[model samples]
Target: MGMRLWKDMQQIVGAGFTHDTGLPTWFEVAKATFLQETYQKWLLYKDDCVKMIETELVPQGGLFCNRTFDRYACWPDTPADSMVNISCPFYLPWFDKVSQGVVRRSCGPTGIWDEDDNGQVWRDKSQCEDELEVTAQELWLKQLMVSFRMLYTIGYSLSLSTLTMALIILLSFRKLHCTRNYIHANFFLSFILRAVSVIVKDTMLERHWGREIVKHSDVSDMLSHQAAIGCRIAQVMMQYCVLANHHWCFGEALYLYYVLIASVFIDNNKLLPYICVGWGMPVLFVVPWVVMKLLKENKECWAFNENMNYWWIIRCPILFASLINFMIFLRVIKVILSKLRASSNQRGYPDYKLRLAKATLTLIPLFGIHELIFIFATDEQTTGLLRYIKVFFTLFLNSFQGFIVAVLYCYANKEVRSELKRKSHNWRTEAVLMCCGQ
Candidate 1:
């Protein structure tokens, strides 16, 4: 049967290819996507089956499904009304492509080869179809991943460029040197680290996952064998940067609250405590998470947080900072409203309320309060449209935060704009004097 199938494949390849006169043209032919390199194994397997059947040759014992060779597997004489499974053929195209799983062949009563609706003998490699279906799903997800990564990659690149420009501008003029700009510089630095770390982590995972999944190696084993330590370090740094960025936003809110609402002055541009909270506090959570991961759930390049406890360890500080910043936002708004009311004694109540609503909307991004809606994230298991919306929004916001902050605080600031204008005028005057002298 195998030999005849092989000839049929040759015949299908060309019109005058076959030497045999009669072929089981009625038999359903397997698609010839098998690897040519594996043809030897196929022949050896087929020969062994033929020899075994010949040695144990027996007349049909009542009703029995005849021993047959189809696709690559040699089906043994199955008893009537019974089904059997054969290990999937590795030589087939999808064998090594998808992860291995259960395979089954169907048979009906009366002990004959399975028949299709057309009354033709059928090869029901149901699991092969399943593997193909899985392959299709995976292909779809891969395309989606590529698209999302592109979106975030562009965002991070844009953010990084803007942040560098903002930092340079902040540092260029000594007149702008205050506690506020100092915090801004540190905030920009955190975002720089964040963008770099995220890019690095993504690159590492692509290499690791691409190699491991395709080759059918266990993820843990692949990580252990490859650049596991470096990848883990990248993961740690990414967490630290993310923590610092969010905490710095909290610092921004706190400083505003203190100076404006509490009427307290920070003497001599002192920001040691704020600096510690922004850069140092992440260490506390990161260290513990790393220790716990090493002791408990060390595997797979440390890319995914399989342990919810570990995830919360990193997340709790970020959430705490966000929530506190939001409270400070409300407090600052209330104070500003009261002061506005006292100063604008002639204004109507409705007018002040309208202004308050605008102020709230404006402060949402300034305090990073808008992130409250996206604070909770969906996991890999999350499906359907909700998951997609969350993923896109969360990724877009996270990646472009540096650019957004730079635009709002540095590029769009009246003070910064005035400084740049003054500098430009001074440079123009110097150039004119030089030309006059010449």
Candidate 2:
């Protein structure tokens, strides 16, 4: 099959030179794309021919029929007249000046022959490389990667700072350590860690840094692998933090729903169980996924390129959490509307529905409605204006979610403002006393 294919290729190349043949057909054009593979197969045939010559015929000295027992000796010694219709057994390197595909030269009275103006007998592989288009595509892809790195770097930095501030506010103020604030603090902490992990992952995976590591390493085999320790750690930590954030949101909704439906305050001591579930359940889910991924395909960073099952490991939990939270939200809304309906004009009721709408807007991050946008807008179709819209939308929402949480739960709250004012007044009083003493 390989020999016949080579002979047919020669005929095709010969036919290509004839003006009567006109342009190459579609199949011939398609065949031109396989030039590299054709060359490799021709090499294989040469190897086989050499092996047959080496094994079958014993060389009298270092020569065979006055020729060295090398590639030339492997050539079939057919008569010059008989070679007209028969294909040459030897492989000759030839460059297609037109289609840039590989062709071969037939053995004449002399040995294998290929001569051009350069006097180089080797194949002109320059034509095989689509340098213009391939390089452009590679550079284009690199630009996209750089842009993503910059976006995530800036976004995560902003998120990390805001989330840290939110955490400090929630933790420092005893008055703010309510059940809702506690859950929000958990989410804030998780998001902060997640942002840090993203930064670290980006740093470790930076092309220059990775290349530098390999360059500086003395042990050739040690630092040569794709899955570096730092990158793998970052991947695991990022996954854990993401899962923890989802679980914390689920915990928040569950707590609120329980309070509304059961009409009882969950004792401060009882929070230990919820805390265990919120933080520890993520470990349960993430560990199995990490172990399975390492066992199955221990490739670079356990990234998204793996089998679909690994993806479902993380996504399924988040989706389930979101679905449950949505159901809880519906129940909570039902309860609020029931109470509003019960209270008539005699009670001088405000627009509770408007309040509910505002509250739902604040809960967008918690309830996972934002995921629907990603689900419907397929990434493949997300190009041009839609791509930019998605980028900006995600940049604002993900990067500034911590800021939104702080504003809604801390700065906007009456109790937090009062506590801040009281602390400021005390600080001023103490400063005046200290200055007088000095």
Among the numbered candidates, top TM-score falls to: 1
Residue pair clashes in candidate 1: none
Tens-digit lDDT string for candidate 1 (52-130): 6777766556777877666356777777777777766544444554336434555668777776687655554556432
Residue 337, candidate 1: alpha-carbon lDDT: 91
For candidate 1, which ten residues in a row score worst on lDDT? Answer: 23-32
Model 2 stretches astray by more than 4 angstroms: 1-128, 133-152, 207-227, 265-269, 340-350, 375-396
lDDT of 2 by residue, 57-102 (tens): 4444321121112222134333322221223323323333224333
Question: What is the RMSD of candidate 2?
Answer: 11.6
Instruction: Kindly provide the TM-score of model 2 when superposed on the true structure, using C-alpha atoms.
Output: 0.64
